[model samples]
Target: MAQVRNKQVLLKNYVTGFPKESDMEIVEGSITLKVPEGSSDVVLLKNLYLSCDPYMRILMYKDTPLSLGFQYSPGSPLTAFGVSKVVESGDPKYKKDDLVWGVTKWEEYSLVPSAKILFKIDHTDVPLSYYTGILGMPGMTAYGGFFELGCPKKGEKVFVSAASGAVGQLVGQFAKLTGCYVVGSAGSQEKNKLGFDEAFNYKEESNLDAALKRYFPEGIDIYFENVGGKTLDAVLLNMRSHGRIPVCGMISQYNLSQPEGVTNLANLIYKEIKMQGFIVSQFYPLYPKFLEFILPHIREGKIAYVEDIVEGLEGGPAALVSLFSGQNLGKKIVAIAPE
Candidate 1:
């Protein structure tokens, strides 16, 4: 095959508060359509779906050290979790036409070095694009965090913050499947209607404590903490005794110079709350278990998911910036190329 290059979205600089479109730049780049002969370590791919997550915002921090997830490097292509088709392979584990999802760069083509991070997509009955959001990282995040950390019983009251986000939406649905009464707090009323039993707009709520009390009259039994500003403070005050709080991403505090402070430590003593923070990588061992549990539901259409896809690498900058402003409808994704 003739070697063809592609376009990519690149980071322009380290970011401050909310990221602006100027922070990212669209540049034409290339990857050899063919893998180098005799090199058995590389896999060449054509990327299709690129995920836009809130964590990507944190990566824009210039001084931030590289962690388990991606960190932004100025003038380099922005990295993200994405789905792609294997066009050429030097690795024996994957070959031509194999579909995969993993930590991929936000470009049309990528030369992935690590086979460990890539998962071959076997279930094509459902949307292959789902690997970017619902059936991918966000799915693992909810399954690991909610089911593993925030153990819920039937008829328990569960609450989720930023309920419309990639992780939050799945968490709410999982709570419902567990036979718990699930309510979500979103920034808008339209998003609140997706899967939540009851949805409230946090901006309209004058007193968050009162709002929580109204929704969870019996106090919250399970709290999926996605937003950790005033909402976390209020949840702490209203938690039922022995309540479980699965501390997911705190999107509300990502851009702040100093994160929001919650002055309710004393409530923990009285409430006996169980609060734990977790990362998806911590649950990689359980990915197969999660797939077994979620794949059936996904294929049967018993479980539903929403995604906000932007076309072309040129839209990557705006799509990412929209996360902080809540401009995206569902899981924000960049479609670098058509399948």
Candidate 2:
């Protein structure tokens, strides 16, 4: 195959405070449309959908703890969860045109080590872009963090922060499935359409603690913690005894140079709350289990996922920066190429 021009979104430098579009640039790079000779287990991918998530901001750091997983280097294309078609491959497990979802470069084409790919995407009945979100990493995160750690029971009150996001939206729906009362808070009140019993715009609330008390009068049994900082502090004060807090991504503090301190953490001791932070990789073993559980609900029209998609690689920078500014309404995705 011939070499082709690959448009890529590259990190210009390490971000300090809030990120702007200027922090990344779209550049034209070149790649052969085939796996390099003798490159065992290498797969050449035609990138399709790139996911814009809050955690990507963590990787943009010049100094990140090694335990945080991968980090982005200046002058290189960003890596993220994406849906792609295999253009060529040296691995027998994959072949030309095989649809897969995994960690792919933010470029039109990527030559990746097979290990980064989670699995081949088999079900094509639903939208392929979903692999970047509800059916992908975020889905796994919500399932493991909520079910595996949350341990919800019937008639319990559940609160999800940043509830309109990829993980939060699904977490709210999953809580409903478990027969729990679900209330969510976001910058906007769009979560009501996603099956949240009540949705509030946290931006409009002058006092978060008062807002939570109004909705969760009896106290929250399980708080799916997505936004940290002030939201977490308020939830701590409103928690029921022996409540569980599944610490998902803390979007509120992602772009902060110095993250705000949570003043009510002492409530964790008084309430005997169980709070645990998790990485999605710890739940990869549950992918098959997750698919089995979610796919049926999806096919039955019992669940919904919203995506805020931007077309082309040129829009990638703005789409990514939108995550921090709360500009994206749902799961933010960049369509790099046509399917």
Best by TM-score: 2
TM-score of each: 0.96, 0.98
lDDT of 1 by residue, 50-116 (tens): 9998888878898774386557789999888999898888988888989899888888888877553
- How many residue pairs clash per model? 0, 0
lDDT of each: 0.85, 0.90
Give one digit per residue, the lDDT tens place, for model 2 in 1-339: 677899899999998889889999989999878788898798999999999888888888888643544579999999999999999899889989999999999999999999888879999999999999989999999999999999999999999988888899999999999999999888874545598898899888999999999999999999999989999999999999999999987888988888999899899999999999899889999999999999999999999998999999999999988887764579999998999
Best by lDDT: 2
The 10-residue segment with the lowest total lDDT in model 1: 63-72
Clash count, candidate 2: 0
Show where candidate 2 strays beyond 4 Å.
66-69, 189-191
